[model samples]
Target: MSAVSAVATDRAQADAAVVVAWCDELADITAEPGRITRVYLSPEHARVNAVVGGWMRDAGLRTWQDAAGNLHGRVDGSTADARTLLLGSHLDTVVDAGRYDGIVGVLMAIRTVARLTAAGPLPSAVEVIAFSDEEGTRFGKALLGSSAVAGVWDDGWWDLEDGDGTTLRRAFTDFGLDPESVGTAAADPSTLIGYLEAHIEQGPYLDRAGQALGVVTSIASARRFSVEAVGEARHAGGTPYERRHDALLAAAEAALAVEGICRASQHIGTVGTMTVEPGAVNVVPGLARFSVDLRGEFDEGRDRVWDAITAAFDEIAVRRGVAVEPTEVHRAPAVFCAPALMDALRTGIVSTGEAAPPALFSRAGHDAMSLGLVTDVGMLFLRNPDGISHHPDEFVAEADIALGLDALAVAVRTLTERHGTGPDGVS
Candidate 1:
């Protein structure tokens, strides 16, 4: 091989080694079964966070736990007023989730800072944040940490309850964090020049397109609702079929209606959960409840799906002489990442000689979306195997991870070199 080709190969191998080391370190933490369960200020999650805090401390980074349970590691730069380049991801996970899901971002940021510290002070500061809970596995709240920092989590949100009777505020105090001090996590708009995150694509778009990198254009809007059906319970064997007012049967009809709604909207609406209450073999169900999660590229599209779904449910309720109530859980509008940051990512991908970056929308929500409300936020999507994520089997090639890191480093370097991590330019 040519000398230049040989050097390129060597550099690639070195980069792969760095990513593997980070992945392995995090894997060790996640391998614990307790960490794999809903952490929710629970004993298991606290133990895991303590380990992570120690890692940060050993690196000479000062650590603090925010009111929302986010763990932040700070590295001071030339000026205290400097808005640091923020990196890292959530440490929380779905039950039995893979190690690399959210923890990879934190590990990558820590490793990058470790290298920078060895090289001497950077022009600007960099903060690695292991956000408290992004998966909502415990308390059914996503982006709790990032949202708190953005000043979006409020009193009502604080009282949010988990599947258990425990409240979020109680969980915070139990975890040795202050609930009232949650506001302190908010960043001064001027100091937050730009925020960047590196995460697995969690989808198949990049792998199918043969792209190693993804420049996220926007995060899709999501609406979640619960549907309930009320009907008279009857003995299955004693009641004639025509005289029966079966809630489960009505719920089944509503499920089909939901499928029709998704099909009419080209599969943007999804129904993931359905349950019939007083569930028994011999008794017809009197009450049924199901959840509908709908998402789309635009608010109008989402609204369209919502309207159709409600109309269909109404029609079903009347036809079956049953009552149906749909309760709104939550709704978030689509959020677009900074265009300038997207362009910067594209430039980095091109510079690395990787295939063209995929310009795509993230179907999954991220902390970046919450941060965008307060500061400039950007994200890079590392291609996943089969675009699958949130599972133990989710995989991303080492080569692709290296490619993503190279692109992330380029973007960070460019921002720091030009703007110096101050708030003046990022807006």
Candidate 2:
């Protein structure tokens, strides 16, 4: 290989190693020992900001923690006033999470900016954001950090409490953040060129296609519902089978109905959490509550599945003589990738030596979905061979990480070429 090519190869290898090591180190900064579990506004969040912010400073970027607790780092473009291109992903993790899911994206963005600034300033400014919350493990409100950035913070969320009965507002105060200043995190849409996120596919699509990277077409629309079946508690032996109104039984049938309807309609549905009342095994369950999470490529399809689930709930309620109610707690509509950004990502993928990378819709919701409310958004997916995520077994190859970083850098360059020359001249 030529000297320049050899040098480039060595840099890519070194960057990949840095990414892997950072992931391992960050995994150690979790609330639980021996397991990764960082939630919103927690002490771990502050620790991670300190570590990642230090790296951002080393990359020669201005760093700050936004009012909403998201960490940010910015590198000036050819000019200080140039339009900004945002790159990042959430840093929070689910319980017992894997190392690479969202953390890798932030580290990769930092490394990408470090490489760009080492050479010279680009045509457009680049900002890397480490969102504080995406898993919503503590308060059960996903995308809290990104939503604030999108200027969509809901006042009602302040009352939301965690397992320890700590209100989100109290948690904010305890974490040294003011609840009222969250609006400061919002960015002016006019100042943004676009948002790009590099994340693991968390599925088998790219792995099955034997590709290292793929461009995202769109993110799935999702709806989460809390369903409850209410029935009178009765003595198991005294109550006849015909007279028994079992809430657990009704809930079981409804859960099955959710699965059947979603399967038939080609949508994704999950009963992630369920609770049964009346601890006594001899007494009939008086109440049953379960959480239903549904997602689809389109909002219309997702709503249709929800409609079917509602009908099923009605049927089960009537048969079992129980009252069933479903309360929606969360909903996010599908967000499509902007055409210009998608083309740039395709260019980046091809530049990585892939013939034609596949385009797939993301079944999982991302911070991009929230950011899409304010600006055009695009995503690049790295292959996760096992199609596993949100668990410790989630995996991505180091070679794929290197390729993903290369593609992301190329994407940034493509954007710079497209928009940089007009307002801010490319260096």
Candidate 3:
């Protein structure tokens, strides 16, 4: 091998070890005593910003915390005419979270920007943003930080309450931030060239394919609903099967129907949460409430499956003699990666002396979905073992992270050079 190739391989290995150590360091700043549970606008949030902000400054970048609580770092380009490229991902984690999910992406970007700056003048000013909230474990509102940056913050989100009954508005104030000033976090769309995020695949595809990285084609379109089944309550023993209208039975059937339809349709659906009313053990359940999370690659196809599921649910409700009602609580359309940015990432993966990387559509929603509202977005994914995530067992190899750092750094440079000299400029 050439001397240059050996040096590059060494750098990837060293950087991977450093980032894995950094992830371990951040995992210790959780609210729970022995688990990872960092949420939005809590003490952990502030502590992490300070910790990562110091690292950002050490990387020769100016750092600051946005009004919405997202931490940011910037390294300027060589020329005044140079464009800006956005990088990085969320810093928050879900309850009892794994070490890599959102954290690895941010650390990878920090190292990428450091590499770019150390190589001398760049054609674009690279900005690394560690968005404060993505998991929404606290307020039950995901992408809060990126939504603010995209200028899509809703006025009604302030009323959202955590499990502890503290209002989001109050939590903001307690975190030493004004609820009204979140608008200041929005970036002008004109200033950004595009957004590129490096994240763990959070699925088994890359590992199964034996690839270290993949380029994201798109983030899934998602819809969520709260479903309820209501029926007459009666004594469990006294009520005959002929006269029974058991809500719990009907709700269970509905949940099963969702699973069946999604499986047959090749879409993803989950009845993640469910509850039944009546405290007495001898009493039949008269009310059952459950949540349905449905996701797919396109809007129309996803909605079609929802239609099929709804029809199946209605049939189950009638057969069981219960009233079924479903309320749509949240919806986000599909976000596709730009072809140009995809090419840049493709170029980067190939630069690592590997074969052309495979492309995959993300089933999990990301902050990239929110950022896509304002600008073009692209993502590169490292392999996650067994596709485990949002759990304590989720894991990624250090060697994969090392490869990710090298790929991401090259992708940023490729993008910057292309955008600077492109025919249209800053697509």
Report the number of clashing residue pairs per model.
2, 0, 0
Residue 120 deviation, candidate 1, in Å?
3.7
lDDT of 1 at 280: 88
Residue 335 lDDT in candidate 2: 97
Worst-scoring 10-residue span by lDDT in model 2? 1-10
Residue 47, candidate 3: Cα error in Å is 0.6
TM-score of each: 0.91, 0.95, 0.96
| Cα deviation of 35, candidate 1, in Å | 8.6
lDDT of 1 at 257: 84
Decreasing TM-score order of the candidates: 3, 2, 1
Evaluate all candidate structures by whole-model CA lDDT and list the values in order: 0.75, 0.89, 0.88
The global Cα lDDT (0 to 1) of model 2 is 0.89
* Candidate 3 per-residue C-alpha lDDT over 1-427 given as tens digits, one digit per residue, 9 for 90 to 100: 2111312367778878889999999999999979998999999999999999999999898999988999999988777766678997999999999989989999989988887778797887889999999988899889999999999999999999999999999999999999989999998777778899988888899888778889999999999999999988899999999898999999999999999999998999999999998847998899999999999999999999999999988898889899999999999999999888888888888778766688999999899998899888999998897999999999888878887887888889988876643235344
Pairs with backbone N, CA or C atoms under 3 Å apart (clashes), candidate 3: none
Q: Put down candidate 1 lDDT per residue, 69-143, tens digits, no spaces.
A: 788897877665555778878887787777677777776666556656666666777788888778887777778
Measured by TM-score, the strongest candidate is: 3
